[model samples]
Target: MLTVSNLYVQYGERILLDRISFMVGDRERIGLVGRNGAGKSTLLKIIAGAQSPDEGIITRPGSSTLGFLHQEMNLPKGKTVLEETLTAFEETNKLEERLEVVHREVATRTDFESDGYMNLLTEMSDLEHRFHLLGGGNKQVEAEKVLKGLGFKDADFQRLTDEFSGGWQMRIELAKMLLQKPDFLLLDEPTNHLDIESIIWLEGFLETCESSVIVISHDKMFLDNVTKRTVEIELGKVYDYKASYSGYIEMREERREKMAAAYSNQQKVVVQMERTIKRFMAKATKTSMAQSMQKRLNKIDRIELDDEDTAVMNIRFPVPPRAGQVVIDVRNLTKKYGGLTVLSGVDFKMDRGDRVAFVGQNGQGKTTLARILVHQLPPTAGEMKPGHNVHIGYYAQNQAATLQPNLTLLETMELHSPPEMRTRLRSILGAFLFSGEDHDKKVSVLSGGERARLALACLLLKPINLLVLDEPTNHLDMLSK
Candidate 1:
């Protein structure tokens, strides 16, 4: 079991975690959930030893290993997907090489009774045992299986990591972590880049994998499918439920209802006690009784209600300008980079106010098509025509990363927004959960989810007849999604 005891974390004056405590049993699947910036990732980082808590200890057996796949990891550029993933068995490979050397030494040595020879034999035996424990043999086959499960193709296995987009690179990292098969796995937003098919495959993989997992994701259905337990972080406190995501939701509502009723009853009792105390105090002979009643009231433990952030986001897209019957028309549209053809002879048309969803495996030209429609990427062959007076507002998959890192949150919005929209910039950002000091925060300092929200907020600054979004809800929190 992995135990986090009285984990306390603070940032500035804000208490992100207040002596939170939880334990994850062996092979337990936990879903870590919270709103954006609620310190869900921070708690995971503390458990993984990537970041330290203000005061706490995480206890796990010495034999158990931990693997954490965070959002901001940087993959090596030169190595192919398979090569990078195989590195997960680094210790295993080393043990195998040492075993070979020892075998050759044993065969060449004639002194059978020598202590040195005996020690070599002992080392070989130990190495073989450890290597088998680490799943040393068939490393390539295991790596390939994980890669394919993460939506990587056979051709992609040989391609350099840098050749893939950020989302695909994230998959490569996830594949490496899965191949490691650690005892405790901490996955942060594992489904952010995956398509529906890959997400389903991952759900099945996690369900069968013999690892205690704490997955932080916005996809409620994904959590419902894979996790058996749910740990929620809210108001600098932790709530643990012995149920899946959906079950937790129902249980949480019941808990809140009970708490609300108890609080209400307590308030009524307190009010009656106060009135009695006031009446007693009016008569001089009953002053002592009033004093005793006041002490009783003061000693009573308050039935405190859980403080929930019920602030609903006031997100409203600008009214789009009217356009012709057809918003966009594509005929035999094709896009290619070098010799790789992402989209070939694809034909699609969107009438005014027509909503369409493009779903496919990663690297299947979803983003490519969206970009081409918005005129960000020119088609290599064929043509795409816009209807009369059609304006396009595009939200790219890499929108968060594309923001200026040095600029403050408010500045980024103002820089991209039109002069007429400047007055409404703060309001729009507030609606997206960027308020007060958050507006002054630099883009570089924001979390991936926060950056994603900011990017989506920026998109609503302008009005357009056609709006194109590629994986827009990937980084949003549950409420935002």
Candidate 2:
């Protein structure tokens, strides 16, 4: 069990967490919910001891250990997926090593009745038992179970960790966390990189996993399936609910309505008090009442309602100008990296107004073809040509990363926007939930979702016939998606 009391965290003039307090019970499944930048991830980092709050006390038993998995991870080079995963049992492996030493010494000694020899037997037995309890003997099995559960096949177990993309790399980290089985687990946006099947698998794993968990996720069904309690952070305040995510949502609305009423009533009372004070202040006979009312008004701390984050994305691809019947024509298309062939000789054609979808396992030619169509990647053999008057707008999977980090979000939009469209930049940003102060934020400081939104916003600035989008919704919130 862990307890956080009177926690406060602030960044410059903006407050992130304001005197928030909550307790995580033993084996409790906690869902930390809040809008982007509401400090949900901040609280998790504090609990995991990776971050220190500006003011607060986090009390936990000395024996309790913490495991943290965040959005970004550092992968080890030259290590296979299974090897990397097995490192989670570091402590248990150390115990096994000590046990081996003790066994060797005992076998070499002749004084069986000596205290030192007898003590070696006790130590060896204790170490072996501890190692067994930590699943040391079955580390491979445990690691394999978690890897497979996270959507990794047996063949992938031998692949180098660095060989996979970011999403696949995330699975490797999650597997390590599950393998550790720490006393407490803190996961931030754990399902951001997971597919639906992996999410379901993780939900089942957490349901039976003994460790207490606190996860910050936007997946409604995922939270509903895995969590037993919910902690919401709104307007720098904490609302604790002993219910699932769906139940918490219903109760949160009721609480919000009641708070709205209280705020309304307080505003009316303050207005009435001000008028009464003004009316009585001009009369000397009523000076005492006027002065008392002035003091009351000055001391009052007016209630503030929670501000809703309801920024909607105003995104639509511009209609391309009239083009020839054939939009794109590909002949003998083939792509190869060294000796490996990704896409063998193939022929494809797309007419104007045609909508096509590419579906296949990862590492296939889906993204490769998308890039080839956009002229970002060249085919190893053959050629692809767009019809006359055809214009293309491409949104790559990692398009956000291509943004200039030194530029402000506003500046990035301005650069892509033409003179005639510059006036509409603010409105366009507001649609993507970036407005007011957000426009001034540097691209380096934007979250993954924010960057993705910015990238998509830029895509809508130009008119094009062929819109090639690759995993455009990967980083977006559930509502945005």
Candidate 3:
């Protein structure tokens, strides 16, 4: 079990978690949810001991271990995939090393029954016992199982991790974390880079694993299927619900309704008190009563309502400008790195107003083709032609990274807009739910979803006939999407 008491985290003057506390019992599955900037990731990082909190005590059993899977990480290179994964069994690996040390001592010792020699023998026996108990001998079998389950083939096991894409590198890290068998696991957006099949496999693995899991994901279906409880952080507070995401939404709505009613009743009472004071102010006989009523009004604490930050991004793709019948045509498309052909002999054609999707596994050239179509990359051996007047707007999967961190939301919006179009900035920001105080927040401080909205919002600054979107929905939450 894990218990957090009196937790307080601050970002300058803004409170991320204000005296918030919660617990994750053994074998429990928790879904952590909140708006993009609501400190969900911060709370996870604190619990995993990846960072420190301003004030908090996290209590756990001495035997318990934590494995935190952060979103951004760099895996080590110069080792084969199987060799890298073998490092997860730290206990067994240490035992094996100690045994090697004992063997060297035994080889040098002439007196086998001496006190020091006897102690070395005892240590070696204990090490072997613990190693065997931890399945040290079956490291290869276990590693292969996990690697294959995560979509790595047997042949891929011998390849250096550096040869893989960033997504696959993250998978290697994930595999190592899984093999460590921690008592508690913290996963932040684990499925963001996974394909559908791999995601489903991971969901099954998470369900059967004995460790307690706290997963932060925007996939509503996955949350409903895997998590048994939901914990939401909003405005520096936590709301605990002993149900799945769907059930939590229902209960939360009911809570909002109750708060609204209480606030309305308080307003009515305040209005009535004001009327009574006004009516009695003209009479000298009721002066004391009027003063009494005024004092009561001054002492009253109004019931605060929950004004949830559900910013609506009120915008749509701009209407397509005039273009020829055929928007783009590709013939004999091929992409290669050295001798490895990622895409070969591919042909595709897109006419005006024709919707298409290039869906496949992680390294299956979907983004490669998109880049070629957008003229970001030249094809090695293909003819990719754009029809007359075909203007393209491209949204790369990593578009969020291009945002200016030091600028405020309103400032960034203005930077992307033309001088004459600057008047529509407020309306545009409002449509995307960046209104009032949200407009003043720096781009560096915005959440993943918020940054995504802002990046897409920039696209509306100009009109184009065709839009090339490559994983444009990477960091968006369900509501934001």
Question: Who wins the lDDT comparison?
Answer: 1
Q: Write the per-residue lDDT of candidate 1 for residues 93-113, one digit (tens) a residue.
A: 788888889999999999999
| Model 3: ten consecutive residues of lowest lDDT | 311-320
- TM-score on alpha carbons, each prediction: 0.91, 0.80, 0.81
Which digits, one per residue and each the tens of the lDDT, describe model 3 over residues 1-481?
9998989988766788999988899999999998877888788788887779999888889867899987667888899999898888887688789888888988898898789889888888887876775568898898888888888988889999999877788888898888776789898888877888888888898898878999998988889988999999888889999999999999999999999999999999999999999999989999899999999899998888765767656776566679999999999999997777889998989998899998898778898889999999888898999999998888987787788899998899888887866888777877877757678889987777778889988878777888898877767776777
| Segments in model 3 whose C-alpha atoms lie over 4 Å from true places | 95-135, 262-303, 316-321, 337-341, 402-446, 458-462
Top candidate by TM-score: 1
Model 2 per-residue lDDT tens digits across residues 431-457: 788758778888976666778899999
Every candidate's lDDT: 0.88, 0.85, 0.85
